[model samples]
Target: MLDIKFIMENSEIVKAACKNKNEQDNVDKIIDLNRMRKIYTAERDELRRQLNEISAEIGEIAKKGGDISSIKVKAKEISEQVKSVEEELSIVEKELDRLVLTVPNIPDSSVPVGFSEDDNKTIRIIGEPQKFDFVPKNHIQLNEKLHLFELERAAKITGSFFPLFTGKGAKLVRSLVNFMLDIHTADGKYYEIFPPFLVNRDSMLGTAQLPKLEEDMYRVEQEDYFLIPTGEVPMTNLYRGEKLSEDDLPIYYCGYSACFRREAGSYGKDTKGLMRLHQFDKVELVKIVHPDNSYDELEGLLHDAEKILDLLGIHYRVRVLCTGDLTFASAKTYDIEIWAPGTEKWLEVSSVSNLTDFQARRMNTRFRSSKDNKLHYVHTLNGSGVAIPRLIISLLETYQNSDGAIEIPEILQDYFGAEKIE
Candidate 1:
């Protein structure tokens, strides 16, 4: 949440951010509501002050053995005025709160100003797409021979875009999850969290997924719970409504969860095989850090995500998302797209973002500084230490042999308990 004070002071910046992010501009309305809120609050305060003075006068008259009924009536009138003003203040504040959540985070100056993903700036490309002597087959084509997954059956069981892995395919998914968790948690770099797949409304709002992306989320009917769209929702809200010590400036957590997205607004997009799915698995990385070092931490977060692809021997490139392409909660983001030769397209496998205290404000997560003994909002960052589906796609397609076999990367061999899937 952008601070209302900051928004009031820097309205233009917030307006530009809303425009850049393709969010509705509610800044003017919020400001108007805030002004009314101030007026109502001041009126209430003044009424209360008058009531207090009238009560004091009534007490003095009563002590002096004089008529106190007039003073009492005046006090009662002022008290009623206070209540009326309080009700007005409550209405204005509620509307202001609602509108505030609609505002998008201000994009960092470094972010490229563009209207689409095509304008995203590529930071670097690592490795090269594997060259095959034979015509490469996509995951679905390779699956027919390897018997990895059953998409039609998954659709029969659930609806379309749900994945059902069988035999080696299931093992591949498990192996990738374990491989990612191990890498991230190794050397105690990130604390592992096994959070619930279902979360309450506040948890969604705390992660800035509510009030905007609710349509793209799966909610439990007749309840306030919603299936998590990503582990970031549960993991990032770990410190919700809490304060930490400055000594714990940087806290790392990694968790694996089944992410569900309704994809309500995603139409005319590729939903073939694992290109997009209603359900997918991911190992999420979250960081709570001091505001001063958030951008640096963002770079480190990107590196940590990149390291997974490096270990897997996959060719991927990192693209810094432009202002218009950034998510509602992210000030800046870097997407890592792995090369899938079979599909002849680059598939985005991970997005590392620096929320820059935007989520911290919404979560009410703060840290007490040892130097000044004051609390300040901590910067929050989250990344797909990598999502599983597309990674599996790249692995299946890139490592395919002439005989329709998959050669697992050396790092993941032990986890898979086999070197190749035939």
Candidate 2:
């Protein structure tokens, strides 16, 4: 949520930023609402003061055993007026809040100017796509040959887009979860946690997953919980409604959770197998840091995610998300896309974003500086240390040997309990 005071003071600047993001529809409305609310607040406050004075006069009249009927009549009229103003004020505030919620976060100055993903500027490519001697099979096909995923049975049990990992596939899923968490814990100095897979509405809103994108989420009909779309929702809300001292400037944690998504309208796109599924596992990295160091820390978090692809020797590149392509809460985002030899395209395995206090403002997570007692919103950042299904897809495609085996990345062999999957 935006600070209404800031918006009131700098409506012009806010409008320009919103216009640049192609969000002009709500700008003028919000600006006007803010103005009206300002005027109404002044009127209401003045009336409240007058009512208090009348109450004091009435008390004095009673104490002196004098006629208080006139003062009582005036007080009754003022009280009725107050009720009317309060009614209008409530409506104005409601509309104002709705408009504010529609406004996207201001883009970082360093972010490149452009509207679409096509306008996104590339950073650099990490490695070359591998070449295969045989007509390479995609992860889905390989899984079929190796008895890894049982799609037919899964379809019968659950609807389409649900696949059951069995034998080698189940092991691969387990290995990826552990492998990603281990790397984040050791290199990133992050605490590891396993958060609940279900979260309340307020928790979802804190992570920017509610109020706007409700259709994309799965909510439990009878409970205060919605199946968490990602681990970030629960992890970021850990410090919700809490205050931290200056000594707790930077807080980092990596969490693993099974994610659920409705995928309401997605069809004819990545529905073949593990590429697009109803349920998947992910290791998420979330950070709460001081405003001054958030960008630097966000970059570090991005690279920490990249290290998994780095250690696996997978080819990938980072792309800065444009305003149109950015998430609602992110001030800036860098998506790390790994090369999938099977599909001959880059599939995003991670997206690191710096929310720059937008999320903290909503969650009430703040830090106090030693210099002054004033509290300020701490910056929030989150990224997929790496998503499992896509990495699994890339791994099966990139590391497959001619003999129809997968050469385990050296770093993961110890965890896999074997050098290769044959």
RMSD of each: 1.9, 2.2
Candidate 1 lDDT, 206-266, residue by residue in tens: 9999999989999997887999999999999999999899988799999999999999978
Model 2, position 296: C-alpha lDDT score = 98
Query: How accurate locally is residue 351 in candidate 2, as Cα lDDT from 0 to 100?
Result: 86
- TM values, all candidates: 0.96, 0.93
Which regions of candidate 1 are displaced past 4 Å?
A: 53-71
Off by over 4 Å in 2: 54-71
Task: Give per-residue CA lDDT, model 2, range 294-395, as digits (tens).
Answer: 999989999899998999999999999877777777889999999888777788888899999888988999988877888999999999989988898899
TM accuracy, model 1: 0.96
The global C-alpha lDDT for each of the candidates, from Candidate 1 onward, is 0.94, 0.86
